[model samples]
Target: MQQDSTSKDSRIALGLALTVRHDGHGGVADDLADLAGLGAWLRAHPGTVPDTERYRADEPDLAAVRAVRAAARALFARAVRPGEPSPADAARLLPVPEALRCLNQAAARTPTVPVLDWADAGPVLRREPADDRADLAAALAHAVIGFLAGPDRPRLRACHAPRCVRYFLKEHPRQEWCKPSCGNRARVARHHERQKRTA
Candidate 1:
């Protein structure tokens, strides 16, 4: 159960991080570029965060989520260690320390308490919000924190395929790129580079 929850949280966090992607023109694209874009994204992935269904995202909400995404991407770059991060945002990533502070602050914005949830199997301790207010940024930050600290952290990776600025959890031991299309692109790019060198 815990593993499942962790995986879900990781997926959500990765989803947030992936908002900044390659623009197909060797530049970065932001999915949360404006309130409309943020609203579209929220509608696309409904109910992932706390109070998402009721999330009345304003300008500030968009900015907050974008900040979280930037921090998440920066930390992702740091996570892969010696390996290269996605090239799309390489030059503009937030410093690792600042990213850490940003994520920490966002997560701490909302307070939660561990409450006993009775289930068919047994009673489980679940973190419940202290108040009724909806803090989408805080909830998303909490998901990112859970993912960063979960068991699958080691499997987290930033895809390096050409024009692919996405992060994914390795599904298998041999997994490299985030998707098959990315793998094909990477292979074709590598082949092209090799041919150029030989030429």
Candidate 2:
């Protein structure tokens, strides 16, 4: 079954957008290779899959998925690290109208059902059955919208480690890298620079 993983932490969508990483030098790596890989990734990160049964049965359109992923990554990169992307780069992002269309289609297919919430003492709404591919597109679109409008949007950052190109939500004011290892690498690089300057 498809679930909303971005409800609690919208960053999950950003993580998905960043599945394809670049070294910023010349190297690149794509984590999602095929439908099976996509399924596995979704299994590891539940709520990402729209309709598990459909996903398991059908072969995903790899070209379409890659196009969406590329557009998403471009948009995120522009938002998080402005001034680095050229005009041509920005033009490659999926147009707002197209993204909205995908979102709307998903919403139309999956209506919301209202239910009483005893714990919260209110009425809650849950999404109906998700159409595998449509839902995935909607989820990605929703996440992008949420992240762009979120208060923590300014905290979105790409890792500064050399040869590493991963985005992360900055947890601390001083955080500049995605992980401790990236931080260590930065420190080591700085140390080498200092030694060269002294020599």
Candidate 3:
């Protein structure tokens, strides 16, 4: 489905936020299980990093990356479902003050040596480095902030399919499940319910 820039960004943020999923059938699954996994995820989702090559070359601190991921997930969870208790000790990972601090830091864009480019049929502006960890945190923070503050925020929803714990941006007014498979599952579940009611 074609989505606007904001929606695309929001989706990316959501993907990051939901790296750890609760498997309703049993245990949980974590995409960022380790440093290698984290690195792979970053490589796959280049949008999450300021400069994929630079980030990969730097070999960012694994501990710091994990911390940022934890903070981002906590912050997004709270934003996605306000008033709900966040993950255990999530506050320590990313407290309100810390998140706001990162947001403010990212908001202030410092001037960098201008570079002329003709990549997009016009000149493109590139800025200097602003602490990698902080930049990533800020990117995630801004993503959630934009999503929450945008019109589409109201349409954000969690999948209702049994044993599924994924969030999705509602495409249609009546859309509920995240995918057609989820919708089919719900339909089968309803059919079972009807049979039980009659029996």
lDDT of residue 109 for candidate 2: 42
- Per-residue lDDT over 95-191 for candidate 2, one digit per residue giving the tens place of the 0 to 100 score: 6566555444543543444544555666666544433244554455555656666765676776767566666777778877878887887799899
* Model 1 poorest 10 in a row by lDDT: 1-10
Question: What lDDT score goes with residue 62 in model 3?
Answer: 51
lDDT of 3 by residue, 1-199 (tens): 3456347567666676667665555445777777667667778767665675456422344544444455555555455564343333333346766755554454343223455676867878765444444355445545555666676666666665665555666777888776888789789989999999999
What TM-score number comes out for model 3? 0.61
Q: What is the lDDT, from 0 to 100, of the residue 134 in candidate 3? A: 34
Clashes of each: 0, 0, 0
CA lDDT scores, all candidates in order: 0.83, 0.58, 0.59
- Choose 1 or 2, whichever is better by TM-score: 1
Cα-based RMSD of candidate 3: 5.8
Query: CA shift at 152, candidate 2, in angstroms?
Result: 3.9
TM-score, every prediction: 0.89, 0.66, 0.61
lDDT value for candidate 2? 0.58
RMSD of each: 2.8, 5.6, 5.8
